[model samples]
Each structure stands twice: as structure tokens, then as C-alpha cells.
Target: MFECFCCPVCGQALIRESQTLRCSAGHSFDIASGGYVNLWVTNRTHAGDSKGMVTARRRFLDSGAYGFLLNRLCSETAAFLRGRGEKDPLIVDAGCGEGYYTAGIAAYLRRQNIPATVAGVDISKAAVRAGAKRGEEVSLAVASLFKLPLCPASVDIVLSVFAPVCGAECARVLKPGGLLFIVSPGSRHLFGLKEILYDDPYENPPNTYYLPGFRQMRQFSEKREILVRGGQMNDLFAMTPYYWKTPADASARLAHLPTLSTPLDFHVDVYERCEDDAQEPPVCEHQTHNQ
Candidate 1:
């Protein structure tokens, strides 16, 4: 399933022996006991969610608060895969946080009689570890979207949900005609929660992403009202970026609300990688040429 991984230093296909992933150049990475691996070369410089944030995210998601969107994502993505005509698909969850959506996609695909191997990559080691604990079906790795651990043109589908968009890297790793699923907040997303936090809250602006080799194929919008109670409210707030930005009075107001019927919106877009007339050459160490 992870035959796509290559050594960062030598660009040779990585082969696994026991718990170690090694390439022809002798560069090696050890798989963590938690069933994930760290392919991060310079992870310290990257900004990823902290352990507390992952804990909060896991708690909030486990509540099935986003079940509606999750179901839609699975159904729509599966339908796309069926239409794509790949018997076995390799699905990736880019920047997957704690693997809730990743597992959801995996389960859906499998239930629909479609065989798919789901892998996930997140910049956060904590996040990857949490995801590894969720299931054995997913191969979780700690890596940045900027430098994907997978080899060029190796994946069939890439899923980015509420994660940073690295269009170039995503395009680099996808095969020609590969599918890219991007999920983002819509205009009405979280307006209910925001209204309690400030005197005036604005609707979320439309999100946009530009991929060099990708063109939009289709899009789906999902909106629903979610009734969040006190504990779940705190869980939601603590897991969101708004938690840090909101003022003290806002926190007090959110704390006081026993229940808030908040509206959530998600925009899912499907893009297909276009064929390159002249594919870019792969960079490798110890460059070889015919003598």
C-alpha cells in the first residue's frame, strides 16, 4: 500500500525490513511502536497542533459532531472513485488530524465494496500518534504537506480537510488524472458559534485553492444545524483556532450558553490532475547518466 514512499536523501524506493524503512542509499527510518512513522526531516521548524490541541480535537470529533459532513464526504468521494474506474485506490488524508475523517473515508470505501488503502500524513507527531491508535487500516506518518513522504506521481487520491493547502506538493505526488478532494469552511460555517463570541461576527469568506496542474471537476456543499451542549461546546471551542483569538468576554459568553444550535457548513471540491506535456524530472542524489 505504501509502495509509493521513497527515500528523501536518495530518491530511491523505500523498502521495509521488520520495523525499519530503508532505501538503497542506506537512509533509514524506524516505525514508531504506536504503528506510525516519522518522515520529517526538519519537523521542529514546522508549526503543528500541540498535544493539547490534538486531545481536544479527538474529543470533539469523537462526539460525532461532524457526522453529517463525514457521511457526505464518504458518499461523494466513493462515487467519484467508482466513476474513476480504478479497481483498487490509494487514498491519502493530507494533514489528517487524529484520523477521524480518514477513518470515516476508509470505512465508507470498504463498506461500499471498494478496496482502498488509506494513508494519512500530518505535520504533528502527536496527531500522527493519535491517528495510529484509531485503526490499523490507515498508515499514519508524521510529515509536512510541503515535503510529502510519498514519491512523485504515486498516489491516486489526496484528501485535504481543514488543512493547509500545499498545492505544489500535492500536485507533485499525484498521478495524471488523479483526484484531489479539498474540504473547507463555507460562508455560513460556524456563524452560530461566532455570534455568541462577539458583538458582530461575519460569515466565513469563500475559500480558494490554486493548483498548477489541477482543474476543478465538481463541488458539493453541505450545511446542517448541530446542537452543541456545554461540554461539547468547550470541546469545540478548545479545538478551533478561534479559541486563541476570541476575547475574554467571548469565552464567558460561550461558557454560559447551555446549548447552542450552531450551523456548520462544508464545501467539498474535486479536482483532477491534468496530464503534463513534459513531466518534470525527479531530483536525485548521485545523479547517473549513460557513459
Candidate 2:
């Protein structure tokens, strides 16, 4: 489906080769065998996602700690697309770390009999590389969200889960009748872990915020109290950003605890690009909670 992608370096048309994508201006990038193309040219590396961080993320996600959240996202996204009579949609996940959620959503779409082309892009080479190793069918790319490689108005659905959102870039790449879905942690998400980690746990404000270009269409929160026993507690802590900042004493405190139950609250927000002639907002029907 991606015959030509824009060069992130110069915005030129990047010609697709069997093994490399070459732009007219001599900027060439290699396409890995696992179905990912690296297109990042900048050096602004993320400190939080080093090689060890990516590994920790993959291990934690693979352990199924976040499987419930993944399943919810898939079901809701499928329902949203079905209600709009959208089939064979092209979906992109910006800042997709390790491809856990992206791959999960792709499988869910397939089960719903929806023809889907899912692409996951991240600036971290380690994250994208790990994602590419997952398998074919899901296209992984090493590209920044600020400058997506897709052409304007080319995508049908875009997802950003606990990651940065470039509203202008999203609006540019989304088709006229496209939807943008975002999943952010609620105010009380992982409160138990926060309490153990920070000396001032109250200082960590809620992470959810609305962006500028996108108008909110629908918002829902999923809250579940999960009792994590044994090693799962460590995995839970490792999967979150708080792990990076948590003090050694806090880590020890969590490590010593045999069992910890925490509340997991996630907010799913969907937005639609406003058009000139559109009069009414998009229709959103809430589904019964599967829990």
C-alpha cells in the first residue's frame, strides 16, 4: 500500500527498493527484512528508551501485564470503525513502542473481517527494531512523529497510546473522513505504584491533555483494580515511565512487597478532523464494559 513515502530529511519522494528506500537527493534508507523502513535522520535520542529500556518494555508487555488494556483498545477501535461503515482502513500508530498494542490491534481487526494495513513508527531504533522482529503484516518504521513519512490525507485511522501526538501532522496525514484515537492514563492510574515510588507521589499530575487541532468527539475511562502478585509487580513498574524516576529505596519497597494491587485507569479519546461542509459531530456509541 505504501508505494512512495516522503523523505524525512528533505521531504522528497522516497523511491521504494527491495531493500532500501532511496530519495532523488541521494538520501537512502534500508528496509529491514521483517517489514520495517528506517527513516530517521536526527540525533535527538530519547534517554528513557535506551537498549535496556526497550528490552524492559518488551519483556513487560510480553508478560501480558497490559493485555487487558490492549484488548480494550482493539475492541473499541473495531466498534468505532464498524459503526462508521469503514472497511479496509489504513491505520498508523505513532510512537508505537515495541509493537505490542499495534500488533494486538491488527490481530483484532483481522478477526473482525476488516481489511487493515497497520504501521507502527517510532524514533527509537531499538524500539522499532524490536517491533520489526515481531513478524510480517505489521509494518514498523524508525521515524519521528513530528514528521511522519506518509503523504497528506493518506491514513484512515491514527493511534497514539501514552505517547506524543503531533496534531498538525496527524491532521495532514489523515484522510477527510478519518479518526484519531488516543489512550492516556487517567488521574488515578497506577496510584498504588506511584505511592510507593515517589517521595511526593501527589506531585505527578494527571498526564492527559487535549491537543490543539483535534476536537474531542468521544471520551471514556476504563478502570480496573488488578492484584499483581510476585514478579508481576516488578514487570508492572518496569513498563511505566515512573520506573525511570523511582528512587532505589522506592524500588526496594516495591520489591519487598509480595503482592500489590493497583488501580489501572485508561482513558480512550476519539477525535475527527473537522471539514468545511460538515454540520454535525461524528456519532459515538458506547459499548458495555467487557470486564
Give the per-residue lDDT digits (tens) of candidate 2, residues 32-151: 765678777777754325677778778767877678888888887787678767556678988887888888888888887877788888877788878777764687788877789888
lDDT of 2 at 140: 78
CA lDDT scores, all candidates in order:
0.80, 0.74
TM-score per candidate, chains pooled: 0.91, 0.85
Residue 142 accuracy (lDDT) in model 2:
81
lDDT of 1: 0.80
TM-score of 1: 0.91
Q: Candidate 1 residues 1-291, lDDT tens each?
A: 345567766678889898888998899988888988888887367568888888988988888888888888788778877888876777889889889988888888878888877899988889889988887578788887777888888789998888877877788888898988888888888888889987888877767665667789988888889899868888888876788888898899889988998888888888988897254543322211100
- Model 1 is weakest, by summed lDDT over 10 consecutive residues, at 282-291
Best by lDDT: 1
